[model samples]
Target: MALQHGVTHLVLSAFGCGAYRNPPQHVAQLFKQVLMQEYDGKFSQVIFAIYNDANAMRRGDGGNVEPFEKEFGIKASVFKEQ
Candidate 1:
C-alpha cells in the first residue's frame, strides 16, 4: 500500500528506549528491516532519529548513530559533546 501510494522518505525515531539495554542489536536490525528493506528505493531518504526521555524506564542514554549510518549506507548529521 505504501509503494502504491508513492510514499517516500521514512522517519524512524525514539529507538533509545527500554527495549534496548537487555539486547541492543535488535533495535538496529528492526530499523533496517522496516525502513531500508521495506522501502528500498521507494524513498529518497530515511531518517533515524533517536531520542529518549530522561525520566523514562531508561535514563542517561546516548544513541549510536554510526552503526546505523554504515548499516544503511547513509550519513547522518550528528554533533559531539564538548
Candidate 2:
C-alpha cells in the first residue's frame, strides 16, 4: 500500500516489543526478512528509530542496531548523548 502510493522512505518503531512484550530480536529479524526478501529495492531508505529512554539506555538497547547493520552490510550512524 505504501509502496504503491510512491512512498520512498519508511520509519519504523518497535512494534509489540514494549508493552506487548514481544521479543526485540525476533521482531527485528522479521522486519529484516520482509524488507530484504519481499520489499528489496523498493524503498529509497528505511529507518528504525528505537527510542533511547532511561530503560533502553540502561539495557543497551542501541545494540539492536547491530543485526540490521550486519545483515544489510551498512554502517549505522548513532547519535550519542551530549
Candidate 3:
C-alpha cells in the first residue's frame, strides 16, 4: 500500500513489547527478517523508533528499547545524571 502510494520513507516501532509483554528480541528479529527480505530496496529509509524514559531505566524497566538494542548490538544511550 505504501509503495503503491509512492511512499519512500517508513517508520516502525517495537510493537507488542511493552504492556503487552511480547519479547522485544523476538519482535525485533521478526521485523529484521521482513524488512531485510521483503522490504529491502522498496523504501528510501526505514526508521525503528524505540525510546525509553530515564525514570523507567532508574526503576530497572527496560521499557521498549533495551531488548532491541541488545538484539541489534547497539550500546545503550549514555547520559550522565544532571
Candidate 2 TM-score to native: 0.68
CA deviation > 4 Å runs, candidate 2: 54-75, 79-82
> How far off is residue 31 in model 3, in Å?
0.2
**Winner of 2 and 3 under TM-score:** 3
Model 3: per-residue lDDT, tens digit, 1-82? Answer: 9999999999888886655666677898888788888988999987677655444345365766777777667765544446
Clashes of each: 0, 0, 0
Runs with alpha carbons beyond 4 Å of true place in candidate 3: 53-62, 73-82
Residue pairs in clash, model 2? none
What is the lDDT for 21 in model 1? Answer: 48
Cα distance off (Å), candidate 1, residue 47: 0.8
lDDT of each: 0.57, 0.70, 0.72
- Give a tens-digit lDDT track for model 1, residues 1-82: 6567776766766465445543234566777786656666777776777543333324333335545556667677765445
Q: TM-score for every candidate vs. truth?
A: 0.51, 0.68, 0.70
TM-score of structure candidate 1:
0.51
User: Which residue pairs in model 3 clash with each other?
Assistant: none
**Candidate 3 lDDT trough over 10 residues, lowest sum:** 51-60
